[model samples]
Target: MSPRSASVNEELRRRSRERLLQATVELVGERGYEATTLADVADRAGAARGLVSYYFPGKRQLVQSAVHRLMHLTLAAALDREPRTDDGDERLARAIDAVLGLTRTHTTVMRTHMALILQHEGFIQCPEQQKLAALLEDTIARWGAADPGQDYRLLRALLMGAVVALLLPGAPMPLSSLRAELFQRYGLAWESGCPPNDEPPPRS
Candidate 1:
C-alpha cells in the first residue's frame, strides 16, 4: 500500500482524537466521572489505550474537553437550526437555551464539567473551550453589544450561574425560574427561544 499523504495522516489523527473525546462524554454521562476511566474511554472509542494519554494528559482533561466539545456543538446546532435568522435577540435567546438545555439533558456530564471548572485547575483551555468561547462572543456581538468580549464574559458568567443554580445539590431551583431570570436579564420575551412551558414561573 502507498504511504498516506500528510493531509490524510492529519485527518486520521483528528478522527481518532474526536472518537476519544466522544467516548469520554458517553461514558462519563452514563457512569459519572469517577466511575469512568481512561482505559474505558479508549475501549469505547476503539482506539489504543496509549492514544488517550497522547491526546489528553489525564481523564479529567479528556472529560473536560469532551464536555466542551458537546457544549459548542449543541450551541452551534441551536444557532443554525431551521428558520435560522440574523436577529440578535433570537440568536442570543437560542444561545441561552442551548447552554441551559444541557443541564436538563446531560445532567451528569454538565454537573461533572461544572465541578471540574470550579476547582483549583479552572478551565482546561483546550481548543474545544476556545470554540465554545468564540461562539458565545459571536452571539453577544449579534445581540448588539458594544464590546463583544466584555459582554461575552458577562453572558458566560450568567449562564454558568444559571447552570450551577439548576444543578445545585439538595436545593436545586426550577429550570423555568432560572430561564426566566436569564430572559429578563437580556430583555427577552417569554416566548423567545425554546421555552419549557407556556406561562412564565411566578415571581415573589
Candidate 2:
C-alpha cells in the first residue's frame, strides 16, 4: 500500500483504543483494581504497553472510560432491544434497569469505577463518558422532562447513589428496594423494563 488514508488511520486508532478499554474492563473485573496494571491491560488487549498511555493518562482514567463505555453499550442495548418503542415511561424504566443491572452483572468493574470517580481526579470526561451522558439525557427528554439537562444530572446522581447503596461493603441494600424507589421517582410501573421479579416488590 502506498499510504493509509486518514479515515483508515482514524478507524484503526478507534479500534485500538476500544480494545484497550475492553481489556481494562476485563482485567479489572478479574483481578480487581489494585492487581490490574496498565501493562496487564495492554497484554490483554494485544497492543503495545505505550498505547495505553497514549490513550489514557493513567490506570484510573482508563478504567473509568472502560466502565463508561460498558454502561453506554448496556443502556443502548436495553433501549434498542426487541419490541422497542418510543413510550417515555418504558424507555425511562429501561434506563433505570440498565444502570442498576450493572451493579449486579459487572460488580467488580463497577465498584472499581465508582471508587475512581470519588477520588481527587473525579470523572475522566472522555468520549465514553460523553456518550453515556448523551444517552441518559435523551432518555430523560423522552420521559417528558421540562429540562433534560437538569433532569439528566439528577438522574445521574440518583443512579450513583443507588450504585453505592448496592455495593456498600457488608451493608449492601436490596436491589429490589433501590429499583422500587427509582421506579417510583420516575413514575414507572413496577412491571416495566426488566423487573427483577413479579408482584411489585412487596410494598413497605
Worst 10 residues of 1 by lDDT: 195-204
Where does model 1 exceed 4 Å of error? 1-4, 198-204
Give per-candidate clash totals.
0, 0
Residue range 1-204, candidate 2, lDDT tens digits: 335687788899999999999998898889999999999999999999999999899888888999999999999999999898999999999999999999989999999998888875778899999999999999999999999999999999999999999999999998999999999999899889999964358485
Tally clashes: model 1.
0
- RMSD vs true structure, all candidates: 2.1, 1.8
lDDT of 1 by residue, 120-164 (tens): 488899999999999999999999999999999999999999999
TM-scores, in order shown? 0.95, 0.96
Task: Supply candidate 1's per-residue lDDT for 50.
Answer: 97
